[model samples]
Target: MGRIAVIGAGMGAMAAAARLAVAGHRVVVYERAATYGGAVRRFERDGFTFDTGPGLLPLPAVYRDLFVKTGKEPLEACVELVQVDPSSRHVFAEGTEVDLPNASRAGVVTALDEALGAGAGARWGDFLVRAREAWDRTRRPLLEEPLWPNWSVLAEREPYPSVPHKKLLRTRRATTLAEVGAWELRDPRLTALLESHALAHGLDPRVAPASAAVLPYMEHAFGTWYVRGGIRELARAVYERCVARRVEFVFGAEVTGIVEKDGRATGVELADGEVADADFVVAGVAPGALDTLVPGTALRGGDEIAPQRGAPSRLTVLLALRGGRPEGVAHRTVVHAADRTEELDRLFGERPGFSSSPTVTVSRPDDPALAPGAEHEAVTLSVTVPSGLSVSEADVEGVLGVAERAIPGLRDRLLWHEVRTPADFAEETAADGGAVPAPALAAADGGLLHASNTTRMPGLFVVGGWAHPGGGLPHAGMSGALVSGLIVEGPQFRGSQ
Candidate 1:
C-alpha cells in the first residue's frame, strides 16, 4: 500500500483521501484551517444559520456515486437531499417575471411563453435543445474523464451547434454566450435569462464560449437540489466519510513546501518545519499556492494547458429577516439589472468595479434549521464581482437595492445582514484575489480549460477547483475521482468506466 499525503482538507482532497483509503492506501490529509470543506462554510447567529458558499447543488449524482464507491452507505442516508421545485424565478428589469419548474422542459417553456410573450418560451426551449447537444458532445471529455493530453482539440473546436443567422447579407453562427443570447433567444428578457446562468458562475457572458451553454443544460437535465440544513452539511458528510474510511486528518497543520528527492515528490514540509514522508502527494490548492510549494520545479510542460488565472469572485450578503418566509415563494430568484450592458461592462471591462444595478441572486430556503422559527426567515443575496476589488459600503447598498426587487421591503424585513467580500473568500480558500473558479468548458481557445490533474512531476497530482474538470461542487468531486484513478491505475488511467 502506498502512503499518500494530501495537502488540503477541501472537498476534492477529502474525496480523494476516502477513495484511496478504501483502496488500502494509508492517506493523511493536512489542512491549514482547523476545519474541512474549503469554500463550503457556514455562519451562525442568534439561532440562524447561513451557507456562506454555494447555496444549491447541481448534478447530485456525483456525490451519490462518490458514496457508493467509497462505502456501502448511500449519500441519501447521510443527508436529506431535496429537489427544489419551480427551480427558480426570474425577475427581469422590465418587471416581467417567470417561475421555471424544476427539470421540466415543457413547464419551463410554457412559463416563459406565458410571462414574456407568445414565442419567447419556444426560442428558449429550442436553445436548450441546442445546449443539450453541447452537453452530450463534451460531457465525457470535460467532466467524466481526466483532461486529455490533446486538450486543445476540446478547446479549439466549439461543441455547441449554433444556429445560422443571416446578417449583413452573410451567414454567421453565434460564437460567444452573448451571441447565443442575442441571435438565438431573440427576446431581451430571454437573453437576460440566458446570460444570468453564466453570471452566476462568475463568467462574463460576453466572452464565455458558446459551449458554456452546458451550464444551464446541466441544471435542466439533472435538476437543482438543496440540502435540508445547508450546503455545509454535504461537506460534513464528505468529511465523515473520509474518517469512516480511516483517512487521517491533521487540522491547523499548514504545509510549507513539497519535499522532493531524486526528481520525485516524496513528502510535504509542514509550517512547523516537520517533513511528513509519503509515497505520493496530492495537492488540492490554487495554482499560485502550488507553485510556492514546489519552488523551482515546473509542474507542467510548456505544451500542456497552463493554469487558469484572474477568474472573478463573488460578494454575498446574508440576511436575517423578521417575517416568516411566505409560502409559494420560489426558493431562488434572480433579479436582473436595469442595464445589462452597463452591468457587464462594470464587471468584466478593463476597469472592473461594482455595478449600481448588478444582477443579484436571492436565495430564501424554506428550511427551519436556518432560522429561529417559522416567524423568521433567512435569506442570502449573491452577486458576481471582480476578484480582489476593495469593497465599500456603496457596493453593499447597491446589491441590497437590486435584491429589493426579489424581496419587497427588503430593508425593513432585514433584521440584520452580514456581507462577505472577496477578501473573506481569499482568507477562506487561499486563492489569489479570492477568485472563484468556473467549471471547464469545451471551447474558448483553451481559455476556460484548467490544468491537468497529472502533472510533469511524477508521484504528484492536482485536485479540486483549480485542477482538471474545473470548479463547482460536482466538478470538485469529479476531480477527486480523476486524481484517485490516475494515482491508483497509473498512466493507463483514462477515468472512471
Candidate 2:
C-alpha cells in the first residue's frame, strides 16, 4: 500500500482521501484552516445559519457516486437532498418574470412563452436542444476523463454546433456566447436568461466560449438540489465519510512546501517545519499557492495549458429577516441587470469595479433549521464581481437594492445583513485576489481549459477547482475521482467505469 499525502481538506481533496483509504492507502490531509471544506463554509448567529458559498447543487450524481464508491452508505442516507421544484424564478430588466420548473424542458418552454411572449419559449427550447448537443459532445473529455495530452483538439474544435447566421453576404456561426444569444435566441430577455448562466460562473459571456451553453443545460437536465440545512451540511457529510474510512485530517496544520528528492515529490513540509513522507502527493490548491510550495520547479510544460488566473470572484450578502418565508415562493430568483453592456464592461473592463445595478441572485430556502423558528427567514444575495476589490458600504447597499426586486420591502424586513467578499475567499482558500475558478470549456482557443491533473514531476498530481474539469460542486467531485483513479489504478487509468 502506498502512503499518500494530500494538501488541503477541501471537498475534492477529502473525496480523494476517502477513496484512497478504501483502496488500502494510508492518506493524510493537511489543512491550514481550523476546519475542513475550503469554500463550503457556514456562518451562524442567533439561530440564523447561512451557506457562504454555492447555494444550490447541480448534478448530485457526482456525490452519490462518491459515497457509493467509498462506503457502504449511499449519499441519500447520509444527507437529505431535496429537488427544488419551480427551480428558479427570473426577474428580467423589463419586469417580465418566469418561474422555470425543475428538470422539465416542456414546462420551462411554456413558462417562458407565457411570460415573455408567444414564441419566447420555442426559442429557448430550441436553444436548449442545441445546448444539449454541446453537453454530449464535450461531457467525456471535459468531466469524466482526465484532461487529454492533446487537449488542443478540444481547444481547436468548437463543439457547440451554433446555428449558421447570414450577416449581409457572408454566413457565420457563433463563436462566443454573446453571439449565440444574439443570433439564436433573438429576444433581449432570452439573451439575458442565457448569459446569466455564464455570468454566474464569473465569466463574461461576451468573451466566454459557446461551449458555456453546457452550464444551463446541465442544470436543466439534472435539476437543482438543496441540502436540508445548508450546502455546508454536504461538506460535513463528506468529511465524516472520510473519517469513517480512516483518512487522517490535521487541521490548522499548513503545508508550506513540497519535499522532493531525486526529482520526485516525496512528502510535504508543514509550517512547523516537520516533513511527512509519502509515496505520492496530491495538491488541492490554487495555482498561485501551489507555485509557492515548490519554489523553482516549473510544474507545467511550456506546451501545456497554463494555470488560469484573474478570474472574477463573488460578493454575497446574507440577510436575516424578521418575517417568515411565505409558502409557495420559489427557492431561487435571479434579478437581471438593468444594462447588460455597462454591467459587462465594468466587471471585465480596464478599471474593474462594482456595477451600479448588478445582476443579483436571491436564494430564500424554506428550511426551519436556517432560522430561529417559523417567525424568521434567512436570505442570501450573491453577485459576480471583479476579484480583489474592497467591499464598501455603497456596494453592499447596491446589492440590497438589486435584491429588493426579488424581495419586496427588503430593507424594512432586514434584521441584520453581512457582506462576504473576495477577501474572505482569499483567507480561506489561498486563491490570489480571491478569484473563483470556472469549469473548463471546450473552445475559445483553449482559454477556458484548466491545467492538467498530472504535473511535470512524477508522483505529484493536482485536484480540485483549479485542476482538470475545473470548478463547481460536481466538477470538483469528478476531479477527486480522476485523481484517485490515476493513483490507485496507475497512470493508465482512464476514468470511472
Q: lDDT at 414 for candidate 2?
A: 88
Worst 10 residues of 2 by lDDT: 294-303
What TM-score does each of the candidates earn? 0.99, 0.99
Off by over 4 Å in 2: none
Model 2 superposed RMSD (Cα): 0.8
lDDT of 2 by residue, 1-497 (tens): 99999999988899889999999999999999999998999999989999998999999999999999988999999999999988999999999899999999999989998999899899989989999999999999999998898999999999998999999999999999999999999999999999999999989999999999999999999999999999999999999999999999999998999988998999999999999999999999999999999867445657888878779999999999998998888999999999999999999999999899999999999899999989899999999989998989999999899899999998999899888999998888899988999999998888999988888878899999999989999988999999999999887988876
- When summed lDDT is taken over every stretch of 10 residues in candidate 1, the lowest stretch is 295-304
The local distance difference test score of each candidate is 0.92, 0.93
Candidate 1 per-residue lDDT, tens place, 238-273, comes to 999999999999999999999889989999999999
Model 1 quality (TM-score) = 0.99
